[model samples]
Target chain A: MEHKAYLDMELLRFTTAGSVDDGKSTLIGRLLFDTKSIFEDQMEAVKRSSEKKGIQHIDLSLLTDGLKDEREQGITIDVAYRYFATPKRKFIIADTPGHVQYIRNMVTGASTANLALILVDARNGLTEQTYRHSYIASLLQIKHVIVCINKMDLVDYSEERFDDIVRDYKDFAAKLDIHDIRFIPISALHGDNVVHRSEKMEWYDGPTLIYLLETIHIASDENHIDCRFAVQTVIRPHSEDYHDFRGYAGRILGGIFRKGDEVMILPSGFTSTIKAIQTFDGELEEAFAPLSVTIELNDDIDISRGDMIVRVNNKPEVTQDVDIMVCWLNNNPMQLGHKYILRHTTREVRAMVKEIVYKIDINTMQRQEGEKQFAARDIGRIRLRTTAPVFTDPYRVNKHTGSLILIDEVTNETVAAGMIV
Target chain B: MSHYYLNHLKELEAESIYVIREVFAQFQNPAILFSGGKDSIVLTHLARKAFFPAKIPFPLVHIDTGHNFPETMEYRDWLVDALGAKLIVGSVQDSIDKGRVREETGLNASRNVLQTTTLLDTIEQYKLDCCMGGARRDEEKARAKERFFSHRDEFGQWDPKNQRPELWHLFNGRKNMGEHFRVFPISNWTEMDVWQYILHDNIPLPQLYFAHERDVIERNGTLLAVSEFLNMRGDEIVHNKTVRFRTCGDLPITGAIESTASTLEEIIFEVAASRQTERGNRADDKRSETAMEDRKKQGYF
Candidate 1:
């Protein structure tokens, strides 16, 4: 048996964005293939596809195209996820399309990503599509950004061209709300500076893309100050062996959970003590953020689905009226004063849009007021009135418990993504 | 004896539990699709942990093809009695007897494709709004792009390309009167993670997973167990070999592999070092390149 070493770290998700023919697929393909994370059958499928296309060479870009129609059209039209792992960390790649008309697809992909991989062609410099992708990535609160200057092979791997493009990108990215920005020169077609160092660029001095992905410090990405746990289901064996096990099953939204702690259940206002935390293997003394475990309480209360369990001292905002920034996702336009289903955490209630305060322009970042009508893929601010009081945190406070979705009652489709402001 | 963190495995389990709860909160009538396989068994156990002190909210629905292994039937019955949940069995034999479906007769005859007809009929009769499945994305190419709450049309058909956009933790489970959702809680788990979690969790499985002496014959580099449903060819010779199943299915199609691993720990180690996939031995999948995709399009869970 081989000895496996464990590296403790947090999880980081990122999405790749660019225009058509900007080599976004090739760049991602190089990262997965170079890491030796591509499965055998996946590789075989790519090989057979490339052969059918009669390219006479293995096209690495075929790896991310999961659908048959996408392969036949030679483009990525939807958001697909690809997973890989190194000895240091695990990676989840949100491979999104790079077309202008599919801006909604980019938003859906970058919604949960911690970083963004913005590809740039060295010869073409920066296009309007590049700016749009970067702008949306910034709007989604992605803190880390990597601007990969690709196609250095066509320019004879010139250092001057690489520096020229990096300067142009910096000037545009400075206007956005971006903090951490890095540049790397690479030829994704030739596999340079992606996983291995390229000798052609003698003046380039930096770690390869694979090295950065494996060594980037992302341990403190989660908010651990506030404690929140939404009750999913109440566990009860009701058998002879174990009868008095009243456990609250849910994922810890934030903070830490330890034995002998005081807790409160929402809507019911019942308090109890945390007796033990149990997994499948055994009981643990403590559990933390993002880990799901069954929590046994000292006292059994009237807690069910759509109820929240939190620390007594720390509580979320409980209100029926909320101001939210919503992005419309359906083709039909938004109808004012219309009621729909608003699902937050584990609770669902009927909600109506009271007023549309304003809509944000994606190109200029300006607010359009008094324009209440919104089409598909529209981002705007609105006030919502629900039937019942819901507990929620700000979007910045916690991503899991703060966000929600709006569904059309008639069409039964997810009409929008809403974030509590 | 020591401090350890199964980071990936724990994350997968947490994600699955979250999805299970989402189904319970969103849908009105829900049930689990249990086949007595490893994945379904793991799902049943997770449902048990999801609601402690209270019973599992939903029942277990099995679309039996009437060609299952004996061990699987015994395990399924025992689990149902222990959990005290209702078990609904939709038989392919019943469907065939009533002219709901026809049994194919040829060299490559199989009941795998016919299971879809029985499954859809069962869903329509029960009026189940959501059916939780144990399908994993890592097992097949068609399943790789599936969402947590997969939507089915009025005819119980799955459209692979035009799926609804699923983002963040918000799952949309709204549908019309006839449509339903097929939710997969463990869509992100792989074969290796499933094995490790089973070992760590101490989940009981069928005896066919372990090594035993069985009369089998070699066909297309795979060992097929000799049973009543399977007809032996002239050139094929039967012999006794120590074999175990990678995936549990019907008696005629699912093939077993030669192995010496008899314990859970040994099976985990053997799975970790193997290069071939776990579904490589499925004779049903070897029928055509798009066999699974076609079956899925016709509403096979």
Candidate 2:
């Protein structure tokens, strides 16, 4: 066992999407195993289960198929989160099954990922799943995409095959809205180029998967250009000691917020300067995206929850109508003109779908016009008419302010995940 | 560029505090399920920070199986008073006395399974719509797929397949009458992360966590504290050993590790070197492969 000063380590969240035999689960298990994240008992349990199933070797995939049903079915049924850490960074892996409502599961995993690991079987080159996962990764605006061409052992560790696959993927990705694409060739089962560089593929001189994960610059991933704050709640100590204190509490959605910044209260159009950035550890001079803090204002504008605090000059658009790329998550098709609860950045609004512009064929990256109702696992473009104006930005700008979820009023289920166009 | 971004611990704390505040805002009656364990204690500390300069709005709910470590109860009460927060206790002994639950008999008997009925009853009777638990996903297999805002039915059952899809920072907390939610703010944290956070934040913990000489009996290679709650049989003898509990479940079935690590730093070092899962010691989990999942399906925390 090894030790390090883990207090100041950076956290990187990544998602892995692959078909059943693409070795996705093996990659995850290998990472956890090599990083010493897997405990002895867990390995023992998996080993026993694998032996019972008459497997020749320790089945790494058995470790991740968490549910009893998932194990019985020998497949991953939903997205399961796995954790591992190196000395440099702590990694959170959102492992999504590549089949069975793949779109919904991928979106759920991709929602919070800074990077996406799209696994491709070297023997199978690029399958429909590769294109689909790549497309969704692009749609979700993930900052980095690492296409791991797994099972290179089966391809005789041929550099030419890896080159062909990479070139084909590069050509296909040109059509998708993706940036910062890197390709790695390795065998997850053999522990090659996943945690350590493999000597077998000496021709491939790229950094190992672990090296890329550790060194990738993610500080610039946040939307630091525009300042946006969505108030989750208001804190009031009602005590006699701090009678007049009113602090707006929320997570910073985008950009940097500092003290003495001239800010405007959204919808209310009230202008005030930030009196202070309050936290339990004491006052901070500034806070940025993803950091939760309480902000004190110069004036009490009767602000409650769902309010936005932004710079007076740089403001998110306040709109009653939004164009969104919605992935329907419910079996019940989205009803036409039916009121659904639209929750975006802490604000809840009554919204109804007005039009389905087009539905996407994830495999071919083509859009079909004149689509009727949005059904389960359907990815498409739709227009939402909200009863109240929502302060928003494009999904590519700031994820917190850019994304929304629609809840079916009758079932009270999260029916769809939407991204602002 | 790096100065603006928070380190991982501070960021995790911030995220948890945000969730604590969200639970306060989203539910009419929310409570924290305090087990006097390190995880729950850390949760309480975060909640206090979430509403600093003001008392925690939600009452700390402890489900007592009557098989407790004396130090745990003492620490629980002391923490409640120190924070000036409300405490609500749901006792399994009371439930057993009232015939709501049957106490298991014989050597393997424990109130661990019966706590579910009392927990549900407490929730219903008190009308607690949301209960914040300090359960981390990395702790168990079934927990890895748990949602931060887990929906429970009117009958206090979880429908794993029908769980709502949680995306981004937006969580759907909508539910019908009689239904409630179990919110796990620290779902992303691992056990190592918890210890590191506790050490980094200088959070106070019960003395039982640090090594101390105590009477214990070894059963199936696990050390059990020799307390009044344990059902000792004929070949089992008690002896004093330096032991500390990694987790604070009910004292009867919760296993302890023999160690001389007396400080947080030492405990962390031991934890790093430990090969077994923390819950690997719990007799309830040792009963079957899917014991925890089965308990969870029946609304066990």
Candidate 3:
């Protein structure tokens, strides 16, 4: 394929998680190398490191060991992002550690990903770690889940073994609320069906992993049916060239937007029409999901950075009682009934945990109903009441409008990540 | 096109612009670290788009090592004039003469490391709380783990393992009075993405980026330009070659690759086919496996 073709493809961000010895890093290394994403000097450095360790072939996983301790211990200590592009798509792979203690890293990486790649060893089928990773992926509302049953070579690429693992995963996944699930048997060490067709698995007749990542329909993933825009900054040139240029600049959270569309700002509830959508150039006729543009309103209604703009009739819920799926990010336990900063879209309000309904055990997919104290790496259904009403929607509808972060007042550390539900 | 969903470049651009604005709203005093390289150039361009009509609400800070390519300096002056923004240059020569830093002596001695002392001094001298850089994660493995809002200690050190938890689009820039943050707006961009955005925006770059003839010598398999600061060995011979710089830093250490890709279009094509990483020619990064990580830890931008 032509290299320019890769430039035109849409981008996708995804995360990978598995146990320590499940060959997660090896799978990523093989995908990058087989796709020609690894450069010559990088390969040479990896080769040198491998030779120093008395290895004959290149230890592919060593390529991503970026930190000093990670290289010394041959393990990933934190979330390391790796970028690669095929002819049909651009990808941002967040390689996260799978140890139980690093569960916060997994949540952080998977927060922005549209898909999650869960690696399960073929020999082990599904273990406790597998269930933990899968549950976390589902709880994050990742639309697509691609389960790669790796190390098939060690298991002799048996069809019966693959079928049994697939059955178990199906039974487990049915209990969750994941939208799309797929199973692929792959030997990440041998580079089978990653970027190319594998003749060893003659019984398999599915697209390669790269092919699925490229062709999977993601356009329908965004919530375009609802119109939402949060004003980030107000642009006023006050110069000779563009003396009257006033634009409300922010990222499009959802829905389709265009020039001459009627819009309204929240809190003030002032209504106006979009005159011209301006970028660095001049003006654009239309804009859509994830595009940041400076919008010109017909009326110069009072608007600031932390204001919301949406369709006048189709508006989000404006209340202080916000039900959320909260994921604790810090090592400290969440302080209940304590005021913390709640940041959503462009607005910031003071909020506190009103109630902790239940905590979900990631490994068992069971809810602990009686649990009141919440700790790090724990996900629970919580009720948050903010000081000021924030305009928001359910996370299932729009990720941008439905997501928020809780900031500790004293240390200024982000303590919890929540999805409005 | 039916409702043109943003391609990769647009999405990356949108996210960067969002981060830039967040820094502006969050920090009381912020400045962009402009090295006149492609990454910084792209960043400045994005900042312009981030706050259109309203001049960028911050200044452009350049930590000069007194060993820059003549073209980069000229480009920096022109951009400052064009953007109508303030340019704050932190000079290493002044730091050396004032005994704030000492100059290294040897065949391969460089002021690259000394620039950090001057940079941290400038950050404190001006009371700039936030220093937005153009560093990218795809450039090196150490950079791959950097946060969007990277906090530095009071003494200016990077603790990769103990960074603040950055999630969603929220950036926490709050710190102690003496402490500051090094915010990378282009943390997610790759080398290819920077070039493509430059081409798409028709942003002018330094002349050294295009094919030019220059006197250089092969040092450690890298074509280092012959300069007053660069000490030539007895066996090394200087020759003029048609070359272009993939990245520009101190002239003595920054190597140029032989190429015929003069225009932006041709350069993108050449980069696409090239097997070596863009940082391969940089002598600073080649010193050790942890060269960048170590320098970053010591507050090198």
Candidate 4:
């Protein structure tokens, strides 16, 4: 096996979801602390804050609950991003508050996560909040789910209790669309089965959480068969050195784009051959998903921002009507026939909510009919008719090309996050 | 074929460049907030690559506190001239002289907090709809929750709890008139990443970052560099110490640490092995537990 250097390691972004007291923050704090990501100054500050608040033990939650109101209320109000890395891979944790009311924040956090860490208390087993979060993980098309049975010390580190909770969770998660579900029994507070193996759980045999995170096969998570490049902007350097140079600059959403490959531009339907893939360092032979590069074409096609370049044979669905699953993010309820600015990929189009199919009861995973009003944190299926054609694919196929956001024209605030169906 | 992937530093640079380009395409008027710090210098370099062959589209806005090291001012001028980019200075000294803000009178007074007023004034005066900063999430706790495209209200106040949800590569910069967005192109880069990038790209930095012999005084465990703007206190004796600044700010409050690492490689190694964060030496952030959060709420860059 070829050894990978620390700098060349791939990055893995994951989301953690747990109830208010499920030790989610503690788990993250342990990961960061054990990995030496937390510095002495930050730890000292955390200690000082703990002392000032009259807390006995250092509140690890203080490390992530950064807002003043959150620190006062002792609850996470928004999505806080935390980064730590092992030698094997770089990790980014989207720590989302696990409350039924903060579903929008969870969705926002989980939208880009490759894995979802769902914490379950050994004493309490699986609760409605767990199911809701798991359903969200499934809805957002998160491929991997790790059911961490936390606080095993409270249950005396019994293997039988771990088995029971795993069984219960498995039965409930059978309804979810998630694959690659793994179970681990450990105590986040005591640092068991996290970065290091716990001697107490002798009967339990599995890789540690950090080990699993570092070794997960995420290279295939992206869709490499479909080539999608949404032009974000045009790089036109009319300088004397490189005058008349026009390059399309954007990040490759999926698949591989190589020089000399024939591609077609969307909406305009103009075809051209890729002349070169350029970067600041130099030109490349090919580029793949998630890489931001500039491409020069042989033909001077009248292409601009919001246009997509793809293979001629493979194409995304371009239509005016789009079916979507929306999670409302604003205080105002989503009204039918209300116009909004829909931002998909790099294109923006005016869209109207034509109909609300049904609202899903997140706790029970049942569709609730006769609900016309969609309030904040409401997840439902809706039909939208756009003023112009938007190129898209199914959310399950390509996350980058399938997702969008709705902006209220009056306030220009993003009101809803949508996944195309 | 061998599997190909970008190293961490290259990936961060690409992401930042992409963001800088997006700002150019999305906003009507955008400017780079250059602070003469390493992070801002890296941001300026990324902007240069983001629009290579063409001069940087946006002007560089410097919020001058008038208490900077001479080395920093000289480096800033040289960089702006070399890049051939427009420079706009927002002077805190001018603000104080015009009675726009009051200067601090205490022994430990700093123009750090006062820079916010000059920054807001400059933005309003220039009608800058978008201002790009070099803030990283790893620097402070409150910054961890900041979005790539941070929105500011008409009054330029940041509501940390009510930030817009940023997903994937989709960033929403649309806003009503009189409101602007503060875009951070390198929010994910860490101190190590910054040093590694500087080393890899051979990016030029101010001389203060490298270790050198300088007159300093120990106060509250922080080494205060001897400068004209820094007021000497009684019972404090000046001593020549080989030290280097972890961060650049107003010379009065910005602290330096004793280090022998002079070269970029040695600095990188030292930073990698250091126990405390880079911002630990900044006296401005030590004011309170939630000092950065409070400053961010009031539109402090």
Number of the top TM-score candidate: 2
State which candidate, 1 or 2, has the greater TM-score. Answer: 2
RMSD vs true structure, all candidates: 3.3, 1.1, 1.5, 1.8
Over the stretch A129-203, how does candidate 2's per-residue lDDT look in tens digits? 888899889999998999999999999999999999999999999998888999999999999999888999999
> Going through the candidates in order, what is the number of backbone clashes in each?
9, 0, 0, 0
**Off by more than 4 A, model 1:** A1-12, A18-20, A236-246, A267-284, A295-302, B1-6, B53-55, B211-223, B231-233, B236-243, B258-266
Residues B1-301, model 1: lDDT tens digits: 0122336667677788888978887788999999999999999988876664466788899989988889999999999999889999999999999999999886556788889999999999999999999998768756777888999999999997677777677788989899999999988777766776787778999999999899998888789888877767778899999999989887888889999889987887787566567887788887765667778888998
* Candidate 3 lDDT over residue span A302-372, tens digit each: 89988888887799998899999998888778856767888888888899888888998878877898676
Residue A82 of model 2: what lDDT?
Answer: 89
For each prediction, how big is the interface RMSD?
Answer: 3.8, 1.3, 1.6, 2.8
DockQ of each candidate relative to the true complex: 0.39, 0.75, 0.69, 0.58
* Runs off by more than 4 Å, candidate 2: A1-4
The numbered model that scores best in DockQ is 2
DockQ of 4: 0.58
Q: Write the per-residue lDDT of candidate 3 for residues B115-208, one digit (tens) a residue.
A: 9999999999999999999999999999999999999989888998887767767677767778889999899888988888888888999999
Better of 2 and 4 by TM-score: 2
